[model samples]
Target: MFPTIGDLISYIFHVNAKVNLQTFGSCMALAFAGAYVVFVAEFKRKENDGTISIVKVKTASKTMEVIVNACIGFLIGYKVVAILLALWQGQDPVALLFSLRGNWIAGGGLAFVWGIWAYSTHKAMASQFIHPYQLMPYIVFMVAVWGFIGAKLFDAVEHFQELLYNPVTVLFSRSGFTYYGGLIFGALTYLYIGYRHKIKLIHMADIGSPGMMLAYGIGRIGCQLSGDGDWGIVNRHIKPGWIPQWAWAYTYPHNAINAGVFKQGYYELPAGVYPTPLYEAVLCILLFLGMWMVRKRLRVPGAMFFLYLVLNGVERYYIEILRVTPKYTLFQLSQAQMIALLFMAGGVAGFVWLTGRSYFSSTKQIP
Candidate 1:
């Protein structure tokens, strides 16, 4: 697996471009792209079903459009120009990108020129209904912000000792994110945004179910590729002939985390561990496809999402069996396992309640 774009490029082109295009970031970009596309299609589908109405503005100002576009352009150029300059100077692209260094003058100058051009060319158009898809970028931005904060917060809590010893490093380091934490906080934030936009919470949840699953699957690909300490317990057992060795177990050499905990005579780990992340990626992708296929047929507003929760919870719970994680003494279960149980129970309760309500409503309507 390619941990970074630099590694992939080096192997493909035989050139040493020591740039770090993190696999996690790449997968996240892909996940967002996929989610956006799926969201647009789902939004259109809902419109066709007459479930939601499009709102049209009487008039829109080209000035506002120009200003927003210009701000976006400026932000992109501000960071990108600096990175490009560093690359040209033969500096490590990743290091330079992450550092507090940039060609601000050039970036600002270009942004100013671009903004002027955009303003001059901009024109006000006839009023039209605003598509639900139009709000996707804002929704995505909110989710990302909340998700990142939640991930970091939960991770910090999990590794409280590390945070106590090295507060700055633990907080600022580019690792130790928890997926469930991100999901809970991000979902709450997304729901609030949807509610503010006068959207039905259940419908919004249904719309996001499949895309979220797909994103999770893609994110796991990043975890697997980077070997970010998400692997399962060490598998000393011999692999069966039918299964691929890499699939059964893996010695993550040159892992992105550079975790060289084991030492027999060498610096690197001597044994292979279960590739749990790979398993999760595969399982989540399959779940995503299944949910996507049956989404339209699930008439109940919240059924799809609840089903997704159940499936996701089950997958995580089972995977925890093979994973190497600290466990609570009460039930010999890991923190994730306990969370998974809660997710499963909540999903079941939600599904039953919704289904029962739907049944009662249908029965009452009968002649």
Candidate 2:
């Protein structure tokens, strides 16, 4: 249901071998390094140009100002976030925060990093605080929160059977992150960020639409490279009228889903179901092309945004048929299918509203 990037990395490097901490640590370090480089480059572009300005904290008082701002941010974020989680799951605030030993450390680290970054950036951009670019902080914050919370909630839902045995463990586990879950929530979170920024919601949506799809594809590549459990089923021989064995056939040694025939505590799926994530990633790239084109051609408010919703919904609904997931009811509908339907409705409604506006009354456009 959930896979960590570490699993794929381990499998790639040494199939049927243990994944050691040192190995994982090295990979994480590399990832962080690459991320920092990109962050710095973007920050500099904003800094060097007139888009954003940064001034050094020259005095002790200014330093304290930064520190206080950072602290206030952390408290506000933690308190509100904790309360929301508690409300959602009917749990104690303290219990939710400390459910996993790593939760406190990870959450605190995220808060600290974003808090300090926002404080410093805000101060630097203070002179132009009201500029349109001021929306970056909210966007970044939305991405982080949506990704983290969505992943957690999806995991909780996916493993409801396991949760029946130990609800607390299921809710708190650090291991239950689904990449697509995070992606979906992150996109929804952008709506609020858009409203706050005073950008027309659909305009803001168009800005991120292409990037969002591409970024998700990148994340899937991470899932594949890490060999987290996102892999498809395995089959010994090629299915009739399908791709040849040599082209698509590959063994996933010691995969938990496919390792039942291997030994105790290890499992593997029977070969050749579908490399669904890979297929999804490829389709996402193509979908991104459509989004980019529509954003360029469609000037109507919300048109590109609606296009994204419809296209993404259609893609996910079709892909769900090939993936292994818990189905609800006798109809065997998947969780993603439910979300896809919602997206499709939103898209259709938006398209209808935008195109049917009074401004276009003089020229009747064909459907």
Best-performing candidate as measured by lDDT: 1
Q: Give the per-residue lDDT digits (tens) of candidate 1, residues 27-74.
A: 778877888888778877877897766745444477776677677667
Query: Which predicted model would earn the best TM-score?
Result: 1
lDDT of each: 0.80, 0.58
Candidate 1 segments exceeding 4 Å error: 11-19, 56-72, 86-98, 110-128, 261-268
Q: Please give the distance, in angstroms, between residue 240's alpha carbon in candidate 2 and its true position after superposition.
A: 7.5
What's model 1's overall lDDT?
A: 0.80
Q: Give the TM-score of candidate 1.
A: 0.86
Across residues 237-356, which tens digit of lDDT does each residue of candidate 2 receive?
545666654236434445423433564555544454466666776787677666655554675556766887898888888878766677899577878788888888999998888867
Clashes of 2: 20
Specify the poorest-scoring 10-residue window by lDDT in model 1. 261-270
